[model samples]
Target: MSIDLSIDLPGLHLKNPIMPASGCFGFGREYSAFYHLDQLGAIMMKAATGTERFGNPTPRVAETASGMLNAIGLQNPGVDKIIAEEVPFLAKYDTCIIANIAGSTIEEYETVAAAFNQTSDVHALELNISCPNVKEGGIQFGTDPDMAAEVTARVKAASNHPVYVKLSPNVSDIVAMAKAVEKAGADGLTMINTLTGMQIHLPSRKPLLANRTGGLSGAAIKPVAIRMIYEVSQHVSIPIIGMGGICNAEDVLEFLLAGASAVAVGTANFQNPFVCPEIIEALPNVLAQYGFSSVQDAIGKGVSVYE
Candidate 1:
């Protein structure tokens, strides 16, 4: 049997189940020079807010074992800039463009999501509430079930595009959070955003990131990501976009196997600009080797309970 990689989200569909995570690929223009723009599944643009942010100061990135700490603070050119410059450039590419939306308040998220809906160039909205570096209610909304659900409900009310809540891994019970968003009419979920972690300079005895704590993302986060995907997938029936520390195609299979409807590539973009293309090309082989015809067959393939 031949497995088909084509999958559909609430308001958007893709040719494959592999997508580039937001904040990794810069508006799809940078990657266009590296490889064919249409090779991947979809493009999740960097997180954008209602207004432009200058981002945090330097020393925003701290390297850790198998992971990295980042305090980027969602420093995008704002939604208007995206509509004028970024979206037009990305529209030229023949792939789904998921606008990753972030804001400090509920109104902020709604404003950005509504703007993305109006752009028409955007295919979906990926809400990134998991950023610990921000103050206006990012981690607050992400970690609390009520807040997460409230944000989802408000954004859904204002958004025309499909909304996928990109969850934070820095919570106590991830399933609760997932269920909250699911109940709030969330179209889909994206599990396991960067975990909250920090690094410090021994000599100075101070945190490396200007924000003191940064979200940790990279190869080391795969296990946490997979576990969260499994938990969220088992709890909710909505489609999920799983992402954490994916570095290769094999990692792609792991997320799908853990029950992710689709998987995202993040920190790997910085490690190797070719990571997305390589995973796109390698997915077929990985499926075939795993006795699967397509990535769809891999979803929820190995979920089991310890009871």
Candidate 2:
């Protein structure tokens, strides 16, 4: 089943369907040193906050069964610094740059989006609402459908740039929240943000993360991500960026087959900074094996339906 990997993420066009998830890829200059940035479909930059954040303590990350727990606290150098520094460096890269923006308050989200809207380099803006690793309010915006829509509506109105609300998998019913955002005018969606979890030290009996609960990501959360993708895809017409445990070409195929128009390599990058390019190169072979012609032809093929 040869598949067509060419996909149009609404307003953004891409040569392939694979992207390097934010945070995990840094500013992309290092990744570019290893491979041509043009080789990637898109680059979702690390989640940037309205104000510069120093992040969390040293023991911020803990390893889970098939996943990893993180309490990075949205450590970013602030929107102004990012636009002044990272944005300029990112513009040099050939791939599309989707700035993942976060804020401690609703007004901050609007401010960040409005600030980025005047820029010419960014292809899209990914709202970081599901940042479960934070201490204050990032996750609060995503846990409730109303707050999710409120944030999306504010950001959407603030910026004309393509808006993609990254949905958190920690919610009780992501479908309702996704539907709310979509109805409130979100340009697109990125399903299955890290799941909230915690780990305890054996002898100390204390939480591994100083913040206690953190978001869980990596290979362990792939199933949960796919499930969210399946449910959200069924309810929304906008494109979906499926990510979580995606590691290789096979995982890419699973996401598309499950209904994701594109896939982002998150924690997998820590293990293989070369994963994005590898997936792009391996996709053709995987398509051949599946008898699909393009990535679009493969989406939603495996979703179960009693109807």
Candidate 3:
């Protein structure tokens, strides 16, 4: 039986539910050499700020048990360069483009959002208010409900593209953050943006990462991601782009069952550059094996079964 893998979110129509999570996929230049970019669903570009950011110092990444810690500090070439250079390159493909917008202040967020208004290739904006590696802006707005809502509202007012807030797993209540953003007019959500973690170098007797703490991703965070998606989906009406520790097709089906309409592959991309296409190829068979006829059919199934 042929299975349907397409998924329709707020402003994204994905051929399949697999897209590389932002930051991990960069701007898709390197991955283009691995396979055809159009074969995947959407491409969530690396975080873009109002100005070009050099990011944090070296020793910014470290490996852990079943996962890795990263404090890349939202490095990027700023919004202007991205729209002029990156978007054009991605437009060559037939897939959707989602820009990950980040800023150190509300005005910066607004500035970046407004800049995207000049371009039509970008399908949606992933408001990155949840980056834990950074010392300011991201995590501050992400953890506070009122601040999250305010930034969401400001970005919505500034950009024409659909706004999807990336929520931090570091928050005390993930559902509260989801509701605040939704009420503030967010189009959708990208949940569980990596839990804040750290590693120590036994030789130095100090933190492993240069920034002392970093966002953790890989197979280790999958269960936490699934639980957050399941809980938040029950409380909010907006669609969610679930991510964290997604390494295979089975993981994609699990995220859909939990409540995500679509899923983003993050750290897995680092392990296997072709992981997104690989999972997309394996999704249909995996869905059929579990009795799912389509990607949409699996969404929220886990929540409904308990309800």
Candidate 4:
């Protein structure tokens, strides 16, 4: 029995609900060696900036108990390179391409969004307002509702395709942020970017990561991601792409049940290059086990059942 795993996001018709999180999957070229790129739902390319970025210094990544911290600083070759080189490379595949854009200012975000507006290769745009590793932009626009709405509105107005605002978990009221972006006219949402954390090298008496504080991701944050998705889903009407420590079919199911229209696999992609396809392959059986006939049938299943 073929369980229909396809999901219809705001402007994306995903073949399946499994794909790599931005920054985890490096533009989809490297992972092509592991599996066919078209086997998954969509590819969220690395965060693009108005100008090229060298990213953070050495020691940008460190391991923790159940996760890892990263301060990669949204390193990329800029929007021009992404559109000229990477977009065409990904267009070769039969997969949907979602470009993740980061900026230090609203103008930068608008510039990148408007640039993508001229392209037909990109199916959607994910506004990276939740990246904790960056200094100027990223979480700065995400923490406050007004700033988050401003960035969302700007990018939404500039982009022709759908705009999904990636939200930060570092905020005190995540639902408020979600509602703010929704009011700002975000087409969809990707909840719970990495939580802010730090690690110290006890022996050297210095910070483990060069940036001192970095975003934390892995199994440790799955609960937080689910809770935020659940909470935000209760308030917003737009579709959600829930992510944060999703490594297996069960985790994906949890996200769907919590009201995510789709989900992105992040840290797991780093551990196993074949993880996305593996999850996509395993989803049918998992859905059948829960008595669901289609992936969409499971979305928000537990939202009303619980609490």
CA shift of 186, model 2, Å: 0.5
lDDT of 4 by residue, 173-228 (tens): 99999999999999999987999999999899999999999999999999999999
Worst 10 residues of 4 by lDDT: 298-307
Q: Where does model 4 exceed 4 Å of error?
A: none
TM-score comparison, 1 vs 3, better candidate: 3
What ordering of candidates by lDDT runs from best to worst?
A: 3, 4, 2, 1
Candidate 2 wrong stretches, greater than 4 Å? 1-3, 304-307
lDDT of 1: 0.87
Give me the displacement of residue 256 in model 1, in angstroms. 0.5
lDDT of 1 by residue, 1-307 (tens): 5568888777777888777888888788888889987877889999898899988887899999998999888899999899789998888877888999999999999898888766887888998878888877789999899989999999999989888999998888999999999999989998788888888899999998888988899999999999889888888989999999999888888888888988889999899999988888788888898888877777888785332
- List lDDT for all candidates, in order: 0.87, 0.87, 0.94, 0.92
lDDT of 3 at 184: 100
* Alpha-carbon RMSD of each model: 1.4, 1.5, 0.7, 0.8
Summarize candidate 2's per-residue lDDT along 1-307 as a digit string, tens digits. 4456778986678889888887888889788878888898999999888889998887888999988998888888899989999899888877788999998899999999988977789999999898987766788999899999999998999997989999988778989999999998999998778889999999999999898988899999999888889888889999998898999999988898788999899998888878888889999998778877888878887775323
> How accurate locally is residue 44 in candidate 2, as Cα lDDT from 0 to 100?
93
Give the per-residue Cα lDDT of candidate 2 at 207: 96
Error of 4 at 49 (Å): 0.3
